[model samples]
Target: MKQRGGAYDPFDCKHYPEADVVMRPGMPLAMACTGEKARIVMLAGGRGMHQRLTSMGLGVGSEIEIIRRGSPGPFLIATGNTRLAIGAAMAHKIMVIPMEREIE
Candidate 1:
């Protein structure tokens, strides 16, 4: 196939009328995209970590938005009207499913 400017398309891609890309399954909170909303799928941590997160309203099934995916520091997330900064390790322990739209 040829693209604009008369450049040959090596892949020979064909345009589809209603092609949609599906998102992958749940991923770690630390790897979630900033500004994206997701639901807590699971927490990989034990009692202590679980309690700590739950106290901050990040329990399982909670819907959260990634405010900042801190690589070397902490992950800033929002749940309800509260915003909390969780450590990188803790963020990695939280598994979340990215949502296409916010849940009410």
Candidate 2:
């Protein structure tokens, strides 16, 4: 599917065009566009960080949306009913796969 950026890749979805571009795989959450939907692919932090995020329901495979992307500040993300304000450092450690989905 097509991500906010023009870079393209063939993802699992078949509904979108085969030529659709996706953001680079494993892009940091901090770089994700606001309102973009993505799935957690990997966590590039220590055990404590992993545990903390997992406890907050942000483990791998979790689907989330960017509510706010504040450069040099905390990023706000929504996963289900849970909203989290995460520091840029922490956000950078969270790798995600951008997804193309209708937001409704």
* Leading candidate by lDDT: 2
lDDT of 2 by residue, 1-104 (tens): 54545765456457754444453347888889999999888888899999999889889889999999978789999999989999999999898878873234
TM-score quality measure for candidate 1: 0.71
lDDT of each: 0.81, 0.84
Q: Please identify model 2 stretches exceeding 4 Å from their true place.
A: 1-25, 101-104
- What is the TM-score of each predicted model, taking all chains together? 0.71, 0.71
lDDT of 1 by residue, 1-104 (tens): 55856885544545522222233336889889989999998888899999998788788899999998897888889998999999999888898988884355
Q: Local error of candidate 1 at 78, Å?
A: 0.3
Query: Which consecutive 10 residues in model 1 have the weakest lDDT in total?
Result: 16-25
